[model samples]
Target: MTDTTVLEQTQLPIGDWEFPRLEPRGYVEPRNRILKRTGYYGGPVKGAPSTSRQVEVLNQGILESPMQFEGLLSGVETLSKTPSVNDQFQAYALGLVDSPNVVEAGDVGVGKSTLMKCDYVLRALTLLRRRVVVVDKKQQSPTEPWGEYTNVAHTAGVDPIRLALGDRDGSRINMLDPALSQTRFIAGDTGALMVLQQAAALLNDGTPLDTWERKALRAALRDGAAQARARGRVVNIYDVLDHCGVISDELTRQMSPTALERMHEAGLTLRFILERLPEEMPGLFDGETSENVKLGEKLTVFDISQLPEDGPAVPLAMMLANAWTLGTIRRSEPGWKTTFCVDEGWFLVGGPMGKVIQSNAKLSRALGLSNVVNIHHISDIPADDPAVAFIKEAGTMHLFRQSKADDAVAAAQIAGLKPGAAEQLMTLPKGQHFKKVGLAAEVRIAHFRSELERQITDTSAGLTGAAL
Candidate 1:
């Protein structure tokens, strides 16, 4: 027989920060020094290093030792004169190391991405020297670390490189110089390479492709073998391009008033311009995916910034799905942990990328690959979004503010707070926010960011210049 036990109720403790303040200075040498001059988000440093071989990344980066990292956190509190936050941050990082994921939430201008970029991520990467995978649908700002990661890699004695947006040619091989052969761009329409090749061929051959022909050409885009098989393939855009040929730069410059009209009349939809993208150039929409993984030393960047103006959220979802699947399948041996840091998680979770991220979510934890996802709004996150499974499973989050009405509602619900409070939290005054600690703890705190970090991250001001 079991004895009935009485449960004791305890009052939640509230405290004034009345403990004696420890004397500042004299503990440790300055450990947490901010290295960057600008506060804005900039990618990796360019011209950092070059590689000679394909890197089989068996381990992640090493910019920080665990002890030093903890020390750095403590130093941050020192800089701000705040109470020791080491325990809180340590708990957060511990949760991340265990689960390997965290969500940053809050209002529009509350510095979600910036916090990720500056407060923690860059230093971690610097410590780890780990290769990074940045999956952001937003324009690749020149200021962010993604672009300069290659330079970081180079400086760290790792052959890191950034592929030009459309590095993959018709063959899907990341095309870059032997020196800059450390980066791999794996996003979008890489399969469309040969189709464009075929269209260019057709154009060279003097054949014209109507809309139906364009569709057929799309088939050719998927596979070079299929493209090759089309010997007498009904001349489409490729044939037309082969025949009329690309307008010479001089011709383009001397185009008469009627020339622009004639060019437009020639079925030059923006898509066609995209479809007939550069074969030799390095940026978005270069070609198809190769069955093989990083072949040479090229750091390839697949620039889909030119992707049809439709919201990239869905397509991005699809791309992330296929990309990780293919990359993982290729590298599924032991000791292979791929860390993927994805920006704008909310959009992909509900769209095409959901299945891709979901299928791998549980499996990756075992593989040592941690997916850190970022999102702009809570509403953009679907109720059953697969990423949520990982987000919950990973059990660490950095909730920021949300200013939008719909987003506020969703954020409020997820944070388990009064619905009305969500809106206020979303519109929280600068430097203040409600941070939800996984599913267990919640805190409303004043947030702060370096001034430089603020200017680059300020979306309201509009991007000052071309992003990488």
Candidate 2:
């Protein structure tokens, strides 16, 4: 009933089934047609701002806009007579410009930390008027930043305040000031718990407390805090120790028989631990926080340089400093930027303080702050660590010459560089680094420091002076 034959037009092929791609068959006449490309070119285009105009906009953004920042210094292209477009220069310069966190890694003698201090941190302090808190852990060597950088800090009109633990003359930082604890608690921070944990860790050689011990310690701190409040005074660690020393019969009666038995043992163990802390760390945590320990200075350096790196003192000082900084910043006006410098980051990264540092990194942008973590190598950070998580959240990374191949490869991976770039990283000269900033391609920067910065940053200055 229906016509089964295909229509003549349908049978006629309009095009070949397998249309071959156009292949050049020798010389052919070139046809002239406008290509429709959809991308930006080097020069000005239809609806985009020019290079200089873009720079102007970026500068304007620095004032109050939500635009990203460019670098502190601009780069000059040397290969071509015509300068590269300023927009490209801005992008290249900002390649390693950090948002709120920067991770700088390299081997010894590679000038990684020096370059960061001289170039970025100093600029932030002097030009941007950002408050700086440095955890100075470098030992008393010719290259120690605490002593050597004093001149630079003075020149910047910042009288650097130093806190050296265990030094009788040094500023005292009480970790258990009830005022600080109560204020932070009222502000919704983990104040009482953090303080209790810090005290236990410092006492237990950085080990976590058992469940019963934690419960007992928490109860004692609460009671001590209440007693201190009644007397119109702030409680210290010693107050908690005193409360634990007298594990009250009234308090024990409220608990079940099993819980009471464990609680008593836990209280005794905690007392034993707390009593020995003052002996183990004499002149450091034995008394109230000194009046000299204030954050009103432009630069406050917790100079734990005298403390042994392998000991608990350094990390304890770091935790205290972290607490102080966070509380002070919380009270400060929002919009004022602060630079928190963690020199010799292994103290925080490889230790229990990494959790605090990780928390800081997460709130950095919201708090209008920047955290610089300078370490000798990526491997210094342990695997599956909160420190590693902090590094991953960093939008800026500066990698100096890596002496070890593994370090170079890890650095390359963090910077998102090509596989071949890892080899280049190992071969980079001193003061040169591969930097990545915010969604930008990696750039090689030859950092130049002034004579004063060189004098301030160079460790060999003292050696040369001694030689002379």
Using TM-score as the measure, the top candidate is 2
For all candidates, what are the clash counts? 81, 1
Task: Please name the candidate that would achieve the greatest lDDT relative to the true structure.
Answer: 2
Which stretches of candidate 1 lie above 4 Å from their native place? 1-98, 140-303, 311-338, 380-394, 404-406, 417-424, 445-468
lDDT of 2 by residue, 102-128 (tens): 788888777766755665567656554
Total backbone collisions, model 2: 1
Model 2 misplaced stretches (Cα beyond 4 Å): 1-71, 74-99, 127-129, 140-153, 156-165, 178-190, 230-232, 249-253, 256-259, 379-382, 461-468
State in Å the error of residue 64, model 2. Answer: 26
TM-score between model 1 and native: 0.47
lDDT of 2: 0.65
Residue 232 alpha-carbon offset, candidate 2, angstroms: 4.3
TM-score of each model, paired residue for residue? 0.47, 0.74
In the range 1-468, model 1's lDDT, one tens digit per residue, is 322343443321221112223343333323222433363334666556645543446454544222213422311221222332222234444663445555666655555665554434443444332333444344435454243233323333433222233433312322211111111222334423333433343323333455534543343333333343476332222333332323435545867858645544443442344343344233332333343324221122222333333433235323533343335434445543344555555556554456556655655555444555666666766567775565555544555667677777776666566446765665565544454445544444444444444443444323555332
